[model samples]
Target: MSIAGVLILPQVIQRGDPGEVVHFFGIPIVLASYTSSVIPMIVVVWVQGHVERWLKRTLAASIENFTTPFLILLILPSATLMTIGPVTMAFSAGISGGVEWIFEASPWVAGAVMGGLWQVFVMFGLHWGLIPIMINDVATLGYSVMKAPVVASVIAQGAAALAVFFRLRRDHKIKQAALPSGIASLLAGITEPAVYGVNLPLKRPFIIACLSGAVGGAVTASGGSAADNLANPSLLSISAYLNHGNFVVFCLGVLISFLLAFFGTLFFGIPRSAREEEQPQELSEDLDSGIPAQPVPADKKVVDADAQVVPAGVVVPVAVDEGNTTDLVAAASGHAVPLSEIEDPVFSSGAMGQGLGIRPATGADGSSDAESPTGAHPGRIVAPISGKLTAAMNSGHAYGVRADTGVEVLVHVGIDTVQLDGREFTPHVTKGDTVTAGQVLVDVDLPTVTEAGYDPTVITIITNSDHFSTIEPRTGIDLAAGDLTVVVER
Candidate 1:
């Protein structure tokens, strides 16, 4: 019975009007298959990363990194297929069974309660639970009371996107994207594209949308209208709802939801302050602290300019050379390789940056001095690829770089490296200094440090490692002063 219910939605939408059609575009192919599921999630993760970068640019601080987006995608799809999908089926069957009992005894009361609770499920991401009953009711019973309220929820969210169209004025780019997505969602059933993309961040509009969705859902429930199939809650599937004479009531519900969310947003909110407005506050604080805001070359933007150190995990090392204007000159000239090819495996999987890793630290021999192993260990850590140096500075404990491709690479040698306390090191560039590929970032006294029993193994990793798709290493024992170590791809 549950399986039958789950299949009900697609059957109705596909069978509804002889003229109804499906279109394949972008990542979400309309074909009914599991294979089609993977790409959309990847696209979602990509957008999430883009949003993270955008936040860094506008706010001058990062809210989160790309890892947050990658994890969200990684978890959502598997759960959707393995857990949420099946659980939804069972949940729908249970609800339908309970509703049937109530309707057999008192139809009107059952209708009222179902209507009220429908939107509640959506707020919790549990509406999938109702899909099966809605579909089965349509196919087996030739109609359903389960699907209609859900459609109303879709309308509510779309209306909320429209709210963003008016509410977010400070950032024109977001507004431009939201307007079209908002309208499309109203006419189609997909809300996540807009929810995660635009509405959620625009703030108050999402809240207004949820409230309106609840109202619209209640209206659909009261009418006892049923959707014929799931069809991903899109407008193209609206033919199923057309079967009922209460189409006018459904339209009315949609209208009310839209108006309520839209007007509520306009009357109650104000535009966010301009970016310029916040800078002086930051600068003022910096001045009061006796530290001034230094101007970095416009090319190298910091990824986590203000992020606290992430709790310790595997601390990877990334080396940075200063730009040519300073000390970082290219060992050799070459066109830019795609960023993904040069990134490490752990970083590539996370879409970070391009760079190379050396398995054996230079001084494996026991005879080497405790601090300085001149053979290749400290100096052995060279630039992964050639590019205009983005940054070169000692962050009190470690040396870091911002590459021309806008990647931030940090190189920390040895464990508890920060404990080196800015001793036994030569810092080549000051803050805001430019460097080139393979330029010496720091001159480490390896033998002296090793004599003190510190492992001079250097860690090189892309700080913004999540921006890449893949990074491959070059096949050679020794890389030229400016030879490529990592190859990157978008």
Candidate 2:
């Protein structure tokens, strides 16, 4: 026999970070380079999960909140001759080159402007615009003098976050998470947690942070020292400052920035907890008109026994009682819960029906039957839509339904709206009562709501609107009753 030929495999070796080495299949590998892109999203994910409730409300508000600013941003040119890449390169070279020139001519002014203006950019969430320049400086020039300002700026941001820790009288959990994140950013440059969680919550703290960042950046600029590499702004990388032979200057600059932000936040004032706290208020005149809001179970039955039935094509004209025919009376009048409180993305989007979203009768995670009970058990439960009671849930335990075509929909307002025991509501119809569109279902006291920190995001889900081929929502942008959602063939 020729005998089987035996071969030994060659080990392929790779490089890694500081003295850390590993053997993969007998191949020694070293990890040297780490990219920020490789940065784990865990921190962001953790922050969001912990503050899911606040974030959900913020997201809802953000959707319509940025309308004006978003519109303006849209009007700007989409294309620019000077691409961000080129602009960044030029800007970096200019800032660095210019600073060098300034240092030679008059370092004081240069420091002040750099320190102050850098903070201004950060306040608008525009700091990401400079990342390319920092990366390029390290790649092409072996160092990045442009990063000094940001290191200082982070210190300022941290200070602002700290202010919230002391000033907040409520929501201790939010403050606890924010304070550490802020301190972490000051020491390590991870500002997202601070920005999103704390400083931004208090308007004045945000402003104070910017001012402090600027002051700190100015000090760094005056030191005539610079960073040796473009690296993530974290305490782990402070050694980069040592390359400039002025580690002391860098430390001082960071310290000054923090003090300025902290003291400035204290002096300028962090908004009182009351300012950020949610309060319920009465609905304004804006809440009136268009969608005639009627309480459910209005007397005899939701459908009028003798009411005129129009043909498919004929318009079902709704008679208006200007006195009580306010379309879309505030849905969650005095007990609106944040849309995010539901946790179901589908429910939060309100895509299910007008504003009605189906969620856990209990809180997210199904904590307990007690803490999260909707009073109605799981599966196809009907709830009170507004404050007004039609017939006291005539079945003794449950109320009647709002059915159109072959479908039925359950209506409920607020989280524990029924708990109000119909305090702020007026019942228009009673059990087994017939009701026409535009009928006054209930009267809501909106003012009493905002003062209580309720969002009043009314929900009108089609609990059983599906039995019909399709229930088309009525025209007009306002999402209220009487807008005419047609039930037709799919």
Candidate 3:
């Protein structure tokens, strides 16, 4: 799709008026514009995938790479320009026209339906059909009723997140995540974080917000409000969209959506299990006990899972044997937690791949001041799986290990502890080092890090998380310095 999109985009006709699109082969071949389209590209890509696979199997290997791309580029552009592109564009335009018809019949009903399910449409790639309608409405009628209800849905989600923020205590990590995610949606009109991280997780908030959005959309459309511009549905961009008649109605509807979702979540409350889960709790007793992190003496021996007593200095082979699943161990001895509790959006949002957080902190203050019980120093961060140290930061705050099975793992000690300038961190390994699971990679002075005002949660992430079918973080349970914490499947 990457290579094909670039090749096909430049040649797609920009002709909007029916008369301007001259017929191909003297037949009325409608060349629909592909600006901001989804369905067409999806269709093309689907076809291209099959086409590329067939090409690879049939073509001679000597010319396979060159011929495959060459053939795909040649076949897709013409098929798209003539058939698939026109048909999908027509289908999208047809959906748009049908929506316009509904608005014409009863704007209120149209608004209610679109507003309630706009997010669903966005999720399923079905909303691409509406883009042309909105563009056409603005150009021909100077306003787009189809565009009016969008903000209602957006605002509702934002309001729900805001409600979650208010519902959780100040010390709760979800509360912290909800606040920024809500602001991003309510102000900036970006709701992916809010929807995925906050609202959807709670379940009820999402349903409530959608219903509230319906009411808001109904009000906006019933009052004959329309959008004159195509822009993100956000508070900052609302002014540009409110130029049509009954603009006050649009604002009023938006306000209603916000208030409704907010109140609905507040009054209804989240699940009992959620409430209980949100309560402040400490990690395992092993971590709470003030055990110092200690390195094994060269003469000492640690027994492997296979029961082989290997000497401390003899680096065990980086473990890479696997089948359907790859299990990662706890790199830090503390309370195992979901990435969502890590206080870092990059980790919590599942954007950096699925992983877990080991909170060494005794309380919800999010400082990992505790290491573990074994009387061994808790500051030691070990390799969870046997892998080559692909990235060993000199600062000793982060390490990226690549398992021979092609799994990339990142072990980051503490949140924002890098600001401490490596003053309290000691690196035991460097880049390109092969390490066994349970081998100490870095030893940090947890107390010094916590006193320096940094979170001491040890974060472990699979950098290539998306490559697998599923990456499950088995958290919220007791784990030792090297216990199974995450499971990734292919």
Question: Number of the top candidate by lDDT?
Answer: 3
Query: Ranking by lDDT, best first?
Result: 3, 1, 2
Q: List, residue by residue over 129-175, the lDDT tens digit for candidate 1.
A: 55545555554456676566566666666766676666666677766
Distance (Å) between predicted and true CA of 346, model 2?
14
Candidate 1 vs 3: which has more lDDT = 3
Model 3 lDDT tens row, 177-251: 898999999899898898888887778888998999899999888877777788888888887655675888888
Model 3 bad stretches (over 4 Å)? 1-42, 73-75, 119-144, 167-171, 270-490
Per-residue lDDT, model 1, residue 201, is 74
Q: Please list the C-alpha lDDT of all candidates, in the order they appear.
A: 0.52, 0.50, 0.79
Model 1 deviation from native, Cα RMSD in Å: 21.7
| Candidate 1 overall lDDT versus native | 0.52
RMSD of each: 21.7, 23.2, 18.7
My TM-score estimates for the predictions, one after another, are: 0.40, 0.40, 0.48
lDDT (tens digit, per residue) of candidate 2 on 1-490: 0000000111211232242465545665342322221111222233334444454455656564555335323321111111221243345567556645665476546556655566566667575655554564565456666677667777778777877676665677767876798778867777878877777666677767767767776677666656777666656777788877367877788888888888777656554554366677856676657458877764645767577576775566566443422222222212233334454565566555433322222232223222212222222222322223334342222233443323334345434455555554455456655544434444444335334544323444554434444444333222223333332333
